[model samples]
Structures are given as C-alpha cells and as structure tokens.
Target chain A: MSKKLLLAASAAVLLNTSPALAASDADLAAIKADIQAMRAAYESKIEQLEQKVETLSAQQDQTAAKIATVEPAAGEQVATQRPATMQRNIKDSSFNPAIGVILNGKYNSFSENEGDVAGFAIGEEGERGTEGLSIDETELNFSASVDDKFRGSATIALAEHGGETEVEIEEVFIATTALPAGIEVKAGRFFSELGYLNSHHTHTDDFADRPLTNRAFLDGNYGDDGIQVSAVLPTPIYTEIGGGIFRGDDNPAGGAEGSDIGAWTAYGRVGGDIGDKTSWRVGLSTLQADDVSRDANEDEVNFSGDSDLYIADARAVYAPTGNNAEQEIIFQGEYFYRDEDGTYEDTGAATGAVDYDDGQSGWYAQSVYKFAPQWRAGARFSQLYAGDVPTGLVGSALDDEGHDPWAATAMVDWTNSEFSRLRAQYSREEVADGQEDNQFTLQYIMSLGAHGAHNY
Target chain B: MKKLSLMILTLGVLVASPSFAFAKTNIFACAPEWGALAQEIGGDKVDIYTASNANQDIHHMRAKPSLLAAMRKADLVICSGASLEIGWLPILLNKAGNNQVQEGGIGSVMASDYVPLLDVMQEKADRSMGHVHPEGNPHIHLDPNNILFLSKVIAERLSEIDASNSSAYQSNQVSFENSWTQAIAQWDNEGSHLKGQQVVVYHKSWTYLLNWLGMEAVASLEPKPGIPPNASHLKQVLQDIEGKNVKAILIAPFENEKGAKWLSEKANIPIIKLPFTVGGNAQSTDLKTMFDDTLQRLK
Candidate 1:
C-alpha cells in the first residue's frame, strides 16, 4: 500500500515537470500538495483494493488447483478446457495525437536516343548514369490543433538538388477556422495559385515527366513563400475566391534578391454540377510581379515598363461514376501571357523597345481511363507557343523567333494500394524548329500513413 | 415526309409525357460503405454515387467537378466525417451549390455523429501527427456496433428526406437491422476463435474492429500511431515480438503492405489482409460481407 502511494506521488511530481503540463510554480506547488493528499487518501484505499485483488487471486489459484487435481483423473478431456474469453473494447475516443511521414524515392534513366543528338552528346559529359535509386522526395508532414477552430500543418521535404540532398519547406501554414465569412487563412511558404500540377507534390504527379510549359515557364517547378486567404462563397453557384501576396523570388531557381521584392496574385473559381455524372469549373487568376532585378547583375538590366502576367484557366471533368478512383476524363486548359517593357545596354548603348511583351500560351487536353482496379491508362496532348521574342543582346537567352513545342504523352500506371503507385510513361516532344525529344520515365510513389489534403 | 414527321412527333410526345418521366432520388456518399448501404437500403428508389472509389485511398481524395456536380443534384449526402474529408469534402460540398447538403443541413449526414469515435486527439492536434481528425476518428464504420447505430440514423434521415416513402424506408431499416444483427452474432461466434489473440497492425484504422473481436493489438509496425513504418521502427517491433506468440500480422488493403510483408518474413507469421472499408477487397463488397470476410481472415 505504501509502495503504491509512493509510486503515485512520484508520478504526479513527474507530471508537474512535463512541458506539456505547463504549470507555474504556484500551480506546481498546489498540485504537489493535492497529490500528497491524494496519496494519503489512496494509501488507505489501497488496503481495500489489495484485499480484493488478493481474494480474486486466491480464488483463481483455487480454481487452477482444482482443475489440476481433476486433470489427472479426467485425462486429455479435462486438459481441453476452453480458455476464458477476454473481452476488450478497442474503440475509445481519446485525445491521442498521432505522427506520420511519407518517403518517396525513385531512379531515372534517360534514353540515349532522346533529346537533340548533338546537344545530348555534349550534355552526356555532365549526365550521370543510374548508379542506384535516389530519394526524389522525402516529406515529413505534421498537423495539430490547439482547439477546434485552430490547426496548422508543416511539411518538410528532403530532396536532391545540385547533386546534394537539401531540406526545403514545402508547406508551413496555420489555418484558422474561426473566420467571419466561413473563411480559412493560411500564411507560410506554399504553392502559388497557378495550374493543377503546380499545387501537387512531385510524387503525386500523374505523369513521370512534368509538362514542357510547367518546366519552362513556372519558375523552378512549383511553390513560393506567401500568405493566402481562401473562402467559400455562399451563393447559388459553387464559388471560391482566394488572393495572396508572395515574396518575388519564391521559386528556388528565381528567388527575390531582396526581402522587400514581392508579388501579388488573386484567383476565383466557380463550378457546379451539370447532371448526375458531369461537373465543370471555370477559374481565372491574375498575377503581378513588381519590377525587380532579373539576375545577380542587377545594374546590367532595367525594366522598360510595368510587367503584369495574366492567366485564364478552365477545366471540365466528367466521370461516369463520381468517384476519385473511377475511370474519368479531365479536360483542363490555361492561357498565360506576359507583357513587359524594359531597357538595357549591352553594347555600350542603351536600347529601349516598347511593347517588348512576349505572349506564351499553352493548353493540354488529357484523358485517363481505368482499365481495371489496379491499372489505368492515360494520354495527353499539349502545345506551347512562345510569341514575340525580343531579338537583342539585353534580352535573356529566351529570345528567339518563336518555338512551338508540342507533346503527346502516353502513360500506364498501377495503384498497388491507396498509398502506393507505379507509373511508366513515354513522351514524344517536338518543336516546330526541328528540336525533337523522346523520353521514357518510370516513377513509383508510396505513401506511408494518412494522405495530405489536395492543394489548390 | 409528312408521315415521318408525324411518327417523330408521336415518339417525342410519348417520351416527354409526365407519367413516363423518370426521376430517381440521387444519393451521394463520400465513402464506399455509405454507397453500399445507401444502395442496399434505397433499393430501386434511389441512384447512388460514391466520391471515393474502391481502388483509391479515401484519405486524400481531391474534389473533382464531377463529385461537386453529383452533390449539387443529390437529394442526400452521406459522409464519414470526423475530419476524414478535411482535405477536399469542404470544397466539394461548397461547390455542390446545393444548400440542403451544406453544414448543419438535414440532407448532410456525418456518420461519425451517431457513433462514438476513437483516437481523438485530446491534446491540440497538429500536422506533426499526420492528418489527425480534429473532431474524432471517423473510421468508426468498421465496428459493427457503430454500423448498427448508424443504420438507424441513416434510415431516419432517409425518411426525413423522402416523406412519401417513409414507410418503405422504415421497413427497409427493419430488415437491414435484422440481417445485420444476425450477421453480427455470427461474426461474434466465429470471432470467438480469435479471442485474446495478439496481432500487429499497420495502422490505427483497425482498432474498432479489433476491439469488437476481443483481439489484442500487441504492437504496431509504425513507431508513431499514424506514421508509416520505417526500418528502425520495424526493427524495434520485430525485437519486441521475438519471443511472444504473435499469431498473425493484420493489415488493411489500402495500407502499404511491404512493411507488413517484411515483418512477417522476419517474424515468421502469416500476413492477414483485412479490408479497411467496403469494396476495399474482393471479399468485402458490402457491409455484411466485409464483416464476414474480416472475421474469416482474423480466424
């Protein structure tokens, strides 16, 4: 009895020191006194409990002894006594916070026949063959809430960059449900309000290779440091409006040199059901980037005029069955235009061109069909046209007459489980200027625990 | 030409007659179990659709335009919400443009509301715990007791939505209850073979079902409750169960079984695959069949 009391007292003292308990000195002292008192009370109560346990133990022993004594005479029949049923209720709602992680790794081998034959030969010196599998994305995502209305999530990914593994913040944001207009606000580093592929993690991408438009236009893949405010509008139409202000250099490849450089983007989407089997959505987004230094040589180039980017996107998805894993056809298209005026001197002479704007537009139509529960086949056709390229030394290397790159992608993917997928794809990339590339990519994505929410 | 026009007009009138108009009650279920139950209970009176398919993980479903459309025209929407649909359900429901299925509306039914939940984070839940449901565990549908409780609630909701077929709904509920009760008894009897049997599971999703069967979940492959099994954690679990008599390693079809298979190989135990929900496995096509298959697997 005294031992139990001592154990309980020590447990209370340990609880007082725990960071999770969060007790002040005064509170700790009071709790200690209360625990002492509890121990004294339990000391007496322990006698009763000990007596009951002893009685039960004795009875159990007596039954065992009786069974032992009868077993010899009854032989094998008595030895076959059924074990007592142990009824346990496993389902209980308790506040138990669980932790989870997702580790995705892959190996890549670019075909020798792909890419420009001469360019490939030159690039081969830097290219490394497949020595072993590489960890494409290893993410640690954690989420918790202080209360019902407050929750936050942070995702960190350890990925290979520049031949070394680096840790990058994928998502670090806190969401508050207690909003005036059924709104949720998140502030952190996150993907921009851009296309579908931009918001999705690379591991969750449908195809092994990202589209040419996304790879060339969207800076360093996807994501940026920003704050986003989103809300569901209460209207007859299913509508959502969101806007964010992000640091200019959110992309890893094109980050802002100064912390003050920033950009703003706003997006609105309206969608509704056409019938039992069909649904559609129309979305429009406008992004504006402030005039800032284009590169480390900030003084070498200057913006001739304000540059604002506009993107208009719309998508329609149809499913014979409205299920996430069912066979469906998703048609999405977006138009992107960048108009900018800038002045720069490269040959000891300042040159300025008005309407030095470049309009790059691309749209893809894709269809995915589930041939079976484990297998799916999909195909997509995409085209990108870069119009009005400035022909000058000051213009970035992007200056060209124009290049219209079109691609046809075919993929076959298998879903072993909800958390695991293996996909193989063959893509033929062709440009009007006679640059053709045929690429084959195989990718495997495996998730360990609870999946994350779909990003915008 | 006049005869062809007359025939077309007659056919159009016949097809457009009000008596011949077919309007099936549209029911949208976010999970597969609800879809199965809705189909079973509504019979020919309703057309059902599930937002999550058999092959996909329901935890990370994206809200597609088609799902929103289905919700928009749906007369009733059933979901297993204890934050199970936190990722995309909100967007889908809001985009559905159907006020009836919005939050606090009669047409919206959260299956967890009727039953007790498990593994609710009493402490403030955070992202550190991979996607914890703030309300409570929404996987309660796996337990027969919860399903029994939810069936009555679903029947009552169905009656409320379609008053004209109230009696029919009630009758269907009675039949379903009777069959479910019988199935539960059979399961209990069959599961007696596994009473006190200790097993290791991959995820906490099987807690409710394991509890009902009186099975002991001695340990898990995951170090943290919801985390995926890593090599280090798998090593620890293997060491812990080295001398103990762990009859089987239980896993859900939706969970990654590679860890379980590796553990089974090292521990020399059979890997018993259990369905997380209806349609998750071939044997678990419906609620009743899910129970039967789960019990058989456990035994």
Candidate 2:
C-alpha cells in the first residue's frame, strides 16, 4: 500500500519539475494541493510501518527467548534435516503418529441355518458374518517412525461375536526403515504375506467377504507372531522376494511342540505396467506348517500333523478412462493347494482315529468394474475340491460326501469419497450336495482420521 | 562342454547385472512439475522417473509396484509435499528402503517446506471441511517464484548427492534462474491487466496461480475440495457468480470438465482448462512453456 502511494507521489513531483509549458497559477495551486494530500497519506503509512516494525522486533525478542530454551536440548540430541519450526510442530503433535479408525458394520441374511461347508472345516472367523444387523470388526490403527532406523505400526480390532464383545490385537509390527540394498526386515505379529489379498487389510477388499478359496485355505485370514524379511530386486521390472518364520499358533497351523518353529513362508512377486492405462502383478508363494494340532467344526473334528500350502496369485487393472479415479476394471485371482498328512478324529461323534494323507485345492477368480466415479460392481466365482476322507473320518467335519464346494457372488458398492463405502452383496454357495446356501449382505466401511493410500 | 557352459553362464550373469551403466543420479519425482524442475536444475546429470503424469490426479495415485521399484533406486526424491503426496509417497519410501531418499535424508526435497504457504488452517480442521490439509495447500509450483526457490533447493541437494558434478548443477541452476527471472517479469507485465479479475475454479488446484496473478477466485464448482460438483452445489455457484464478472471457469487437465462446462454455459463465460503442470497439453511440454501456455490461455 505504501509503495503505490510513494510511486504516485514521485510521479507528481516529476510532473511538477518538468518544464511548465502551459501551467497557469490555478494549475500550480491544484498541483500543490495534490502534493499536500500525498504527504498526509505518506505520514499515515509511515506510522503504520513503524508500528509493524515494533511488533516484528517484539516477535524477534520472543523467538530469541525460545531459542535460548531450546538450545539446551539441541546440545544433547541434535535434530538434523528438519527445520526448527517443523520440529516444534512434530513435538506438539505428541510423537506425530498417524492415527486412524475404520468403522465397519453389516446386515446379513442367509437361507441356510448352518454356514459350515461340508468336507472342509473352516476356522471360526471363516464362517459367515453375523446373520442379522451387526457391527463388523472396527479397526483402530496407529503408526509412526520409532526412529531413523525403524518404523512401527499396530492395529486393534473390536467386534461382537456370539453375544460377546471381542477385542483382538490383529497386527503389531516394527519394520526397519534404513536397511541398505532395498532390503526390509519386520518383526512382531503381522499377517502372513501368503497371497495378494492376505497381506492387505480386509477393509480394503473389493467384496464384503473373503473368497471361498481364502476362507477354506487360510481361514479368512492368517496372522501370527513372526519375523519377515523382503527385498526388492534392482531389476527394471518390479520384482520382490520375501520370506517369513512364524509360531505355529494360528489357523492352518496350531499348537507348536516347545520352542520349535511352527511355520515358514517364502514368496516371489513381479509386476509392471503394460501401457499407460494398465498394470499387472503376479506372485507365487508357499507356506509349510509343522506339528499342527487343530480343532474345527465346533470341536467335533481334530487334525494333528504337518500341512504344506502353496499359492499363486495374479492381478491386472485397466483404466478405461485415463484417470483410474474415475473408471477402471480390475481382475484378480488366487489359487491355493494344501497337502496334509494328518490324523483326524471326531471328538463329538466319538469316531475312531484315522490316518489321512491327501491334498486339497481351491481357486477363485473375481472382476470389479468401476462404471462411474462412485459406483463399482464386481462378480466372483470360486470352487474348492476336497481330498479323499478315510472311513473313520467320514462322519466327521472332514467328510466331503463326494461333493465339491462352489460359490458364486455378485456385489455393487458406492463410494461416497475415498474414506467411505456402502455395499450390497448376494452370494449362493453349495458347500454340500443339494444344499444351496443363498446369502445377502449389506455393509458399510468408513474410514476416519489419517488418509491411507491403497497399495497395488 | 563343461568349460563352454561355464563361459556362457558367466556371460549371462554379466548381461543380467542390475547396476546402471551410466553415472547419472536417479531422481524419483512424485509429480510432473517436479520432474520438469529437476530436469532444469540437474540437466543431463540426472535420470528422472516421474511417478504420475499430468493427465492423472496425484492425490488419487496408487502405490504401484513400479513406483516402488523406481523409488528403490532413487538417489533423490522430489515432491510438492504438505500431504499432497501423503497417500502414496510414504508407502513408496517405506517400501523402497533406499537410504538416500528416505525421510530426513539429504536427497529428500519437499517443496512446500521452503516456500510460504497459503490456506494453512488457523483453527482445528475437520473432515466436514473436505480433505483439508492443516499444513496448507500443497500446490506450490504454480507460483513461478516458488518454482525458482525449489530449483535452488533441488540443485543444492543434487550437488550434495553427486558432488563430482557440483559445478555443473550450480551453473545449470544459475542459467535457469536467469531465464526464469526474465520470464517472470514478462508474465508480470502481461498479467497486470488480470489483477483483481474474478473467476470460478473447479478446485483449489490453482490457488497459488491465482494468488500470483492477483486474480480473485470467486467460488469453486465443487461443493468442497476433493468432492465432485453436485446439482445443488452447481446451482449455488451459479447464483454466487451471477453478475460477479467471472472472466472464466478455470480447471486442470485431470479435473472432470462437466461441471465447468455446465457453469460456463449457464454463466455465459468461457471455460479455460489450464495445463496445470508439464505434459498436460501439447503447448506445455516443459516448465517454461507450461506457464507461458497458462497465461496465453487465461488471456
């Protein structure tokens, strides 16, 4: 404001200094009057500038005092790379951990009274969700860099199960941040990176429920206390290889005998872009569980032995519109094969122990299309084939009754924003011969707090 | 036969080696503008891999494996920051495990940290405000001065990372500063008439640009930031901009143009889709042309 006034005043003075070609006495008086007005404006502007200077000096003094107090800590632990102001903000935010919460709820309807699939004893969580309106797992997450060398994250899930409120610590892990040579190491309890979807949180799933293959093969989810190390290769194409060792206390793996390692996993993944609009990733993984003692089908069945599982996954995404945020189609599939040689017993039916040695496999294929910015529709088909059941185990939950289980599901979801989604899904599965289970589910998953970017 | 097979195996190993043949520093830019800026400052001494192009929305970017691979080898990582790339950059940095470009590393350059920001939330912000960044708007590259400031930062980091080419980076930055300063003066002269002119915007994407040109943003087509424009919101905008002398409805290349088109037709004003960043349009192939094309279109 003062600069413009000064410029006008200077311009007026220059005009007056120029040769007076046609200047009369009245013109001179008018010019003098203009100069007087400009002087008054300049006087007020100077007063304001002086006030501003006074305040600035006062602020400088306060800052000097603050620096004196902070100087002592600076000597003890020197903070490099971060500006002083940013450091102050980080301190003010109480360690600066990213905190987030996911609110998920669902209303489910099922035609069949029992959700159990014959021939395969799915785990507790693998069963269908609450039959009526109920809140699903609510996840509370917190993550932050512990230091320059490590970063930590934890997730706690709260849900209602069998008329009881259940709180479970789903994942808690610390990962190395500064490992050289593209190698990362993580420790603590985390989901096993067995397949593509297993590593991701269920809230990020394209459908409301896990695929039949995932449910039967890995019991909806597989998380256990473990340590994992992964390395991204230096190749131009995206390639990563990882391995993990876990305690054999989770589904597909049970009680470990003493301090021995329960399960171990190894995986390799490769991905790249096909064009400007499409990208794809393919991965192969294997998990081996030893000394397993598992009870399934509400304790009516017991299996104790070693189990080995292998998985192959493939995913491809094409953005019909250049902006994937607007429109896209995703094709994802996973196949799992498990070979187990174990002893099966029916505790409830008092069936005699039987020696079982066989292999079981399941595969699922799904496609989701985002027809509009907010709307998406998806369809999935899955089938599971069971191995031969010994005579003693025929009446137990492991009995297949010579029928393979298969399911078909269709769903449509609307995203209000990046943080919220509402979905409706319908599915039909014949887990046993001539027993069709028709299921309908309405679910909402809303995220709050920190914005999380989806991983591909 | 064994000796011949061994020789061929050695040859295959050499051929499959992953090390780069050249000595140029690897620069992973989160957006196209930073990629363009890195080019201006690093010149031929850097190999830049920009994660997102001008036609894609960086806010909605996925943490793709390809980006992870690129980040894994990055000697330097440049981004607008201030939570603009918060969704994906953190994931990439964590997964990349590259010591040079990790947070607090010498090669990390978050542009917003250096320049004064606009729209920093004064009070507690909430989700009702629509994806507000408490740190402020991250679109700092729109101001040419901000770009110049970031160029110096990028050059300094490049020098620190690849000190053997320090002189080259410094000299390149000097030349870019000279040309850019001249261009800024020219733009100031040409845009003087645009001072205080009002226009509607599709999003707050052009906050820094409008502020630099002394143009006023009368309203936004979207009801809020990150939200698509709805019928009620468009109607409200129509009423708000009525007789406000809104010269144009400004939008970015990646922004949906439907709301802008509807508003333009209803308000009888033109819709100007700005290149927004480098590679947004044919005329905006580089940093200099991006600004030049933006001003040309605005006029």
Give the fraction of native contacts in model 1. Answer: 0.14
Candidate 1 Cα errors over 4 Å, as ranges: A1-100, A111-133, A220-222, A251-261, A296-306, A321-326, A343-355, A394-396, A431-434, A452-456, B1-61, B65-78, B81-299
The 10-residue segment of model 1 chain B with minimum total lDDT is: B13-22
Candidate 1, residues B1-299, lDDT tens digits: the string is: 24324433543443234421226667889988899888767877788978775555576556765565466556788888777776687656533445556544567777876666777677876555554565676788888877776666677677778877878877887899899999888888888888788999886777788778887888888666445577898989999998889999887665667789899999999999877778768888888888888887777
CA lDDT scores, all candidates in order: 0.63, 0.85
Docking class of 1: incorrect
Which candidate tops lDDT?
2
Which one is best on TM-score? Answer: 2
For each candidate, give its TM-score against the true structure. Answer: 0.54, 0.87
lDDT of 1 by residue, A1-456 (tens): 999999998888776767444646778888899999999899879988999999999999999999899875574232222112212111112322223467666666544333321101111111222323676668877665434444566778887755877888888776654443325567777776665566666666667655555554454244667776655554445666666666766421233656643566667677766654466777776666655333312233333333456667766666555443435665666666655445323222244432355455566667677654457888887766655644554334233335566778899998755556788777777743455655666778776545444532
> Could you give candidate 2's per-residue lDDT for residues B253-294 as a string of tens digits?
889899888888898999998999999999999999999999
Q: List interface RMSDs for the candidates, in order.
A: 15.6, 5.8
